[model samples]
Target: MTEPTSRSAPADQTQKEGSVVMQLMKHGKEVGVPSNELSSANAAADQKGQPTLEIRKDYMYRSTGRPEKTDMIKSLLTDQDASRNCELYLSASSNCSAVESSEDSEEDMYRDAEEIEREKILLCETSSSEHKVSVAPETDIMEYCRKEWRGSTPVAIRMRKGYEAVAQKFASIRRVRGDNYCALRATLFQALSQTTQLPSWLRSEDFTMLPENLLSKYDWIKQWQLKHRLGRKMGEISDEIKEYLMLLRKKWKNISEIKGPVEKQEACDKLFKNEEEEYSLYEALKFLMLNTAIELYNDDKDGRRVPVFSWLLFARDTSSNPCQLMHNHLNHIGHSGGLEQVEMFLLAYALQHTIQVYRLYKYSTDEFITLYPNDPEEDWPVVTLITEDDRHYNIPVRMCQETVL
Candidate 1:
């Protein structure tokens, strides 16, 4: 080819063109285009025309520091009127760069704000919602005293007065008893001797008159003796006490056998009635049933066979309609096999207690059954006993065994 000339073009044009091509090559690398292909295209365009007059890549612009070369190319390619078009490329590049910088700043600001908001949310979630309060013992005592006497009903007023008297008597007895059973027993014996006929010397006359100051000591004994003798002989009993005991007995009997929603509601009502104000009779029954159920379950493990019918009796008391107590008992028993067995243990005692309760107060078992829908097969009296032999009893025995071992 005519001694392929190494002398190329003007240094400024060459440098300007080379810089633009190199920038294009760098951008090509960033966009994953072949750098070699771009270099070949640029070389071909340079060789085809006067170096200053050549048009290379379309994106090359004056703002990129190639103003003289770009202006020359634009003048050669178009009429004099086209000179204005050259500024368009310069302005577009400036605008694009500005937009990119602004977007980057906005993105950074958003990230920072999000991080702060996330930290604030984390702090809120970890903090406790309620403030802690420390209550003094004297404040609690005063509150209790206030609650005990706030109501002015005849029964409430009487109960408050009785409690005050009982508290005073209890304090005096505590002093005399001095927490010694032997001393109490001696005191009781001496009082017993004085209350009965005996020789002065032989009967220990020092125990004379049975000390009126010790009247508090004899309260329980006097009450018990009075109930045993006067209650049985005269057949006179306090209606309120009898009602309370009857309700308790019914609750003990009916818990496991309480099968339906209506009965459960009734039972729950009886147990929790006025629960906000005072110790409910239902609560006492529930406590007693829970204890009895646990005891029965333990006894069942020792091979003591208790009748299922007896449990039904215990669970079927109607005095105050103990369906709720029975329901709770059954719920615990069904979930805990140990509890179920304890319930079984209490069956006989519960049945006997139920009979006594029913004798004192009349209640309808049919009414209870009506409230509690009986299971099919007429197995109304039978409590379902889930034993180790039951295939459906899937509780892992190994875990319990491991604990025991």
Candidate 2:
């Protein structure tokens, strides 16, 4: 194969950099370009007693003496007076040598410019990640288990179940791929492993789907309707959440374009903003879950089957919708939306069973920190916990641990 070659730089300013400028620089304070030849901006600045050149710190102090102006040759050579600027060329270097030198200098400059542009593009991508939900390339589930652990290692969940002991104490990790609602999916699968009321859609072999995808599950949604004490009709709840999925689907295309905190906040607002015709996506889910939890309560008050969504109720008035203030349970982020943690806590609290959270991390040690909600008498209501991560990590589920095919 032919060797890769560098792109040629423009044969102008870049070529002039280390040539005549170097000769003038070597001459120290002697060879001075006429100050009149400076650019008008520089001329105006110089007349007002300002420094003529914005130069490097080392370039500021020359060998001989502190000159009134630095990089004078650079300014003069770059101006329109090209022919007059040739006087500073070194006599030792022939015209042919100078031409060759200029070519190399041009090539080097071009490479530097390319590198800078690459860095700028990378910076833009990094900054824009707030709104862009990145989906990794699809990988086989089997490959996930066989592959050697790289980057962030997956954490096995810790929960006590007499039947299975949470997947034989984390014997395997099944990676969930190709979806935005990963955290929600993972949590639901793990937390609801023992629940007899799990919807068939959740257990289907190919059922990796979001809440919006569940619009057809009438029976599952019925649970939502029966449990909701707010008495919101099931039809209304279904329509609101369907609209949310529609917005998110369209946004998958536009999200890459979103950048900065402001745009991200706007996107989140759009997800939560209810217009004249309908409620925001967030509001829709809030109400849907509201009804579902109510249904669970009515079904079996002693079982504490569903999450305590009444915690979402606001008896007092607020500036905004009371629903927005109930975001304390947890904030969902990842594939689509998530609430397995909040759901688990609500179910556990209702059933009078304690839930333990393992915030696994691979820092100086290969271990996880356990988290428990504070006592009811604390400043906050049920629980107030914050987990910080300085690095990336993985979470494995307890619901159904299967080997890759």
Candidate 3:
């Protein structure tokens, strides 16, 4: 909001990434993955030289699925009326909604504030060595949750002097396993957890194939899609996607349909065994998230719009690609990026009042810094904690790590 500070990606790097579906449609080509795109992804493209779904133009859009651009323009009743809400979008299609939205309510205010539009994907290295990357114990990330940045020590004194107010407001630090994707997984975990309440409309349908544990995840995806009008932007889904979605529905319902957990897992494995579908699902998920970001960033009312910082986010490197980051894959070196400490929190959190993160960098001289800060009255709740080692892994080296499309 305050010119986005240095935390934001630079203007040139923040160029809009068009439609997520259209961009991914490019990879659907037979030419294979391009090198420039590879630089930002962790290991989404597999060692087998295959993408999740070899998307084709025909599958990207259906003539009957939705109207063409001309028809859409002609159908509009009034050009003077530009205001549109989520329901309006769910009922009708509109590309104009990608970067526009109305004023935020309390919940949306929280959501909008963090929707600092960005998309720079990155992945972390997962090696068999089992050598932990830092000296700090995993549990140490929790210390700063309750501890104030205080004391006579220089770093502590500086934190207290500069950020005591916002630093003290954070609830608690959340620690997710570093085995892989602590950033994305943890963020999704919180988002899914917060979205646990099932809408009554969703309960009427039979999703007997999904595992009981995953029904909520599926529903949350649907709920989020409609709530954000993403379904409309995507137009009518293809029969193949619909079939795949149904297959997934059946597979997930199988969790409850089957008698035992072991049998259930086996059934689930059978469903997900297809590497192609697995990759397709991953890409599909990223596009859905991309849609959410674009829609929220475009939200406008009375000609005023809250700008998101960038769709992609990274600790030090500004040029990361989120689409590549979300996919899980192992490289020739057997290193998997699926479970690394990528800055996945960006996926869950969006433009908001102010969310500050604090790291206890035991390894550095200026060990403590106010990563995010805001007035409580003006901003939503804030802050997350990490160890010095955690910060090290989050920095620039992994951006240069070996892994190509």
Question: How does each model score on TM-score?
Answer: 0.16, 0.26, 0.29
lDDT of each: 0.26, 0.30, 0.27
lDDT of 3 by residue, 1-405 (tens): 111112322333223322222222222211122122232221122111223221111112133222111111112213222221101110101111110221112113222222322101111222333233311112222244224332344444443433323233432333334433333333322222223233221232432222232333333223222112223455322333334445433333445456664554344344334544443333333333343333333332222222222221211121123222222211100112231111223332332222233344322333233232211213233223333323112211101232111
Candidate 2: RMSD over Cα atoms? 28.1
- What tens digits encode model 2's per-residue C-alpha lDDT throughout 1-405? 111111122333333332323323232212121132245444333322233331111223234222122332323234333323323321111122232333344334323454445545754665555223222222332334323221121221111111123233343343322132333323322322223232322234322233334435333442332112245554555455555545433443343345554564345334322232122333333433433343443433333221112221111111012122223222222212233332433333322223333342222232223222211112211211111121112333322534211
For model 1, how does the per-residue alpha-carbon lDDT over 91-162 read when each residue is reduced to its tens digit? 000122232343344334323454445545744653443111111012222233344335444434443454
Q: Regarding lDDT, does 2 or 3 come out ahead? A: 2
Q: What ranking of all candidate models by TM-score puts the best one first?
A: 3, 2, 1
Clash count for each candidate, listed in order shown:
15, 14, 46
Ranking by lDDT: 2, 3, 1
Best by TM-score: 3
